[model samples]
Target: MKAKLITLAVVVVALGGGIALASASSEPGSGPPAIGVVRAVRSGTDIVLPFDAYRHTPAEINVIERATAVLARDCLNRFGLHWAPPTVDAVDTSRPTAAGRYGIVDAAEVARLGYHAAEPPDRPSQPQPPLDVLMVYTGKGASDVGGQPVPEGGCLGEARRRLEEGLPAAMPGERFAELDRELYLTAQADERVQRAMTGWRECMAESGLRYADVWAANDDVRWSAPEPTPEEIATAKADLACRTRSGLAGTWLAVETAYQQRVISERRKEFDALATALHARLAHARQIVNR
Candidate 1:
């Protein structure tokens, strides 16, 4: 069966309110500029950015401020931009039905393992984290330029409505309008590591190899350590050596390198093999489709 991937998008707006709060310095490589998340509150021709509810990184905060500056400079660019911290959406991977609903690993071992996926937040009329900077257009030029009042909503709502209604009728230019929410996310080495890990797990499970300790460490383990310490590097090298000695090192290294490169082409190779096996098993298992 072909894999299925589902991605849901939401839109919310910032809300009225002001409160002062603070946090300690963010860990290096923790996330992007903004400390928390950001959402836009729409009222009339005015757009207010509320930053009170969501957690943000310094990079995330910086991006928001810079984006806001661009908007102001360009007369409130009405494009959707989303800011996200380090996160992945939670997913169920134990069954075949899920293949069509989310990105599937296809291998039974990966199904036993779980994952979380992060999404861009863009809604109107929703509570937003406190703002590092609130953007309110208090001028007559916006109205004079034919800027229509965004119906009451948060950043997400506005994004949805914009998609459904099409860009504002009076948009300065057709190209000036967009519907997809803007996202500010952290840059990582890439998903090559994850894909490689998935393949390794699947291969081990198929061979009846019981490596639960290794399994547990990879599943849902956040990269809390910003920089790899000498000890960590030595550990990785040792682990690779063990896998090599065990004849699985080639597979592990390939996946690891791909992950570092921000790509996981090998994962597809693994997925294809697992999918074929699953097809044969399900044919004889007499399982219901949607139970």
Candidate 2:
């Protein structure tokens, strides 16, 4: 479990950290969301879940990436390499939110993209660093590069070390993700969600779209096109209307929220520890970016 959590923490931090240091330090949230099932309803994008508090915010991601770049840049300079750090920007929203967990929550997005992925931001590509720089940046599991001793995991590894300075051996956030996945699967399989999906299927059938459930509808292969076809748009629009009418989203979220609450209650100590570690790690990353 300790090894797994450390790996998870590394993945989370690698994906990046969140926003302003003042924001990072001012309102730290640690584990086990306190909001009730009722208040959690209709929350933004319906993608939110109790476990979201333990996840890294977009601003945090920005800070992590920026700090990593800064550290990498400094390390590369020792070998007479001129490094231009890649641009790092925080996103407005975090992904894989509970919204899509139940499928097709946003009518507007579905109407526009029709299950196709939203276009990614246009970031101008930065020039790739030289081979020697790459070797130094990643450490490439080497003892030294250009006769200068390389730190374990390279400079990138060093930045992670600094950011995670005070974290426990096991780190925290990843286990939430692991358990959240389990809970999500568990919640959806509940009889209530199964019944709700039945109603949703019937609703979709009225429009002649025969799908086993919401998941089937959302995963329709035709929607994978580079562009949404007119047929796909119509189907998606119908899928959205049926979803609203059947209350499948509402039902699924309710079930999931309840499951999340149960888990939080059961593992309060574990979650609290993870949340605290996340806050501390973010604080360290923010300090790096500002410095």
Candidate 3:
């Protein structure tokens, strides 16, 4: 199954030395504030689950792709064509939070790799397969191939259909993007988040940095340069220090957690359906891979 990937707006920083920093928007009156869910609490903190938990791991995704490739290869072979499964790259989709969430908090990484991390070598681009091969694999409106009518859905689609039998047609993580957006907007108006942002701003001021918010601190033109300037590095260090001192990331996390709990309660049914479908798809994919 194709994993549903969503970008989370609320950034939670899991810092080193046991400091979990959090921050939230201080903008006033964006929309109605989120209400807390009564039954979503566990030991005072809201029981919020990371969305990545339901996603397929890189290894699992590779397995699915390999299975699909195998099906495609066999279909092409029937037409006296030799085809090899393309080498699939595994994407790391397991990070709990997005990179650069706290804006250059990783001093070591910044010093070593600058603004960007080293990317893996890309797969070699291959030319399009012959028309007969394409017709068998993709069902590209060929009347007949190897004296047999091309199967409905083509080879690739048939493989996916088999792998996703008894599951919903919708992609995994489809509803999560909408849910994250709603939670983020609602969190911005949360009273607790506003108070936390105020404390964060004051902390930054005390450190001789005058920024309205974390976003503003990150918006400097220095950051947009082809390379990181010395000023940008120093500013990033200060930003991390101030955020840590104010506990901005931790505070924002608490408020956002409550909001997410409420969202989970409201969307429990949809979440469950998505989870079940994804599990079924993975199971089918595993069966295909193991065979």
Candidate 4:
């Protein structure tokens, strides 16, 4: 529960550049039109349609670009108005402006389904609030990797440091120990925390590790015995479980290879799936239009 959510939050923030900070002014007029879903009948009452296709993929991005182009051109053609694409820094998909809201149609698909077609759906006179578009590239590939070269606030190393310092304390009585044993430690060890651990390790390797430093910390390689007692093994397992649940596993095992590889692989797949789906939806429109 707590552990998993924290880990997930970290992963998302790492990949997506942190929880998006709300700006004082993300006015739609100054930003990209935020798209929302609309349920409407296209042709006969027989054909019900959802005008917004929520696909986030390369193909979907293309659809967005094409649709925007068509809409912009149409608005110009019909209403004698032109709109500039919003700048990247101003894109705030989480919160869109109302006045700048644009109604994005799947165009050809909407027309084929019997929705009244606007040769260009981008009409300033349509009375529909202006809408800026958001095209997201999603899937496994978009997951975060700590070692990848990023600007200062992005390294896994920094994340690890913060994790060690402590996250906002969990609700009272919900110590890392209790959370790990009760909710986070997957029965199979292959389920949740283990995978996160793998991701952290990969981040370390990518960032480069110092064996001397690691050995110095352990002291066992140079001064103590290599084998751990049964009690030590049990302690280690418990510790790992505790760390995983707390989202501290990545910071703890920042040196392990197996863990990091798994994390990276998982994120890649997530992004890939998102991209694939977006492409499919866009292709759907193309099929109808070409027909």
Indicate which candidate wins on lDDT: 2
Model 2, span 1-291: residue lDDT tens: 000111123235421322111111122332323323432223236556677676676677777778777777777787666678777464434443343456556666777776665554676667787777787888885677677888888887886676666665433344444556666776677777788788878988888889987666666777666678898878878887877776777777777777776666655665676677777677777787788
Cα shift from native, residue 286, model 2 (Å): 1.5
TM-score to native of every candidate shown: 0.22, 0.80, 0.65, 0.20
Winner of 1 and 3 under lDDT: 3
Per-model C-alpha lDDT, please? 0.27, 0.63, 0.54, 0.28
Candidate 1: which stretches are off by over 4 Å? Answer: 1-152, 163-211, 215-227, 244-291
- Pairs that collide in candidate 2 are 16-61, 17-60, 17-61, 18-59, 18-60, 18-61, 19-59, 19-60, 47-98, 47-99
lDDT (Cα, 0-100) at 20 in candidate 3: 18
Model 4 C-alpha lDDT per residue in residues 1-291, reported as the tens digit of each score: 000111211101111212222221232232222222222311112211111111232333444444444433333323323444322321223211111111111223322321111232232432332322110111123233333322133222332233223222111112212322322222214334345445534443443422222212223232233334444333233333332343433322221223322322334443343334344435543543344
TM-score-superior candidate, 3 or 4: 3
lDDT of 3 by residue, 1-291 (tens): 111122353221111122111222222323334534323121112223354444554565666677777766776676677777776443443343334333333545444433333244456776687776777788877757768777677877666655555666332343444455555656655676677667778877876888877777666555676666677666666666665565555555556666655444555565455566666666766776678
Point out the higher-scoring one by TM-score: 2 or 3. Answer: 2
lDDT value, candidate 2, whole model? 0.63
**lDDT at position 44, candidate 1:** 11
Clashes of 4: 31
Candidate 4 scores a C-alpha RMSD against the true structure in Å of 25.6
Per candidate, the number of residue pairs that clash is 68, 10, 7, 31
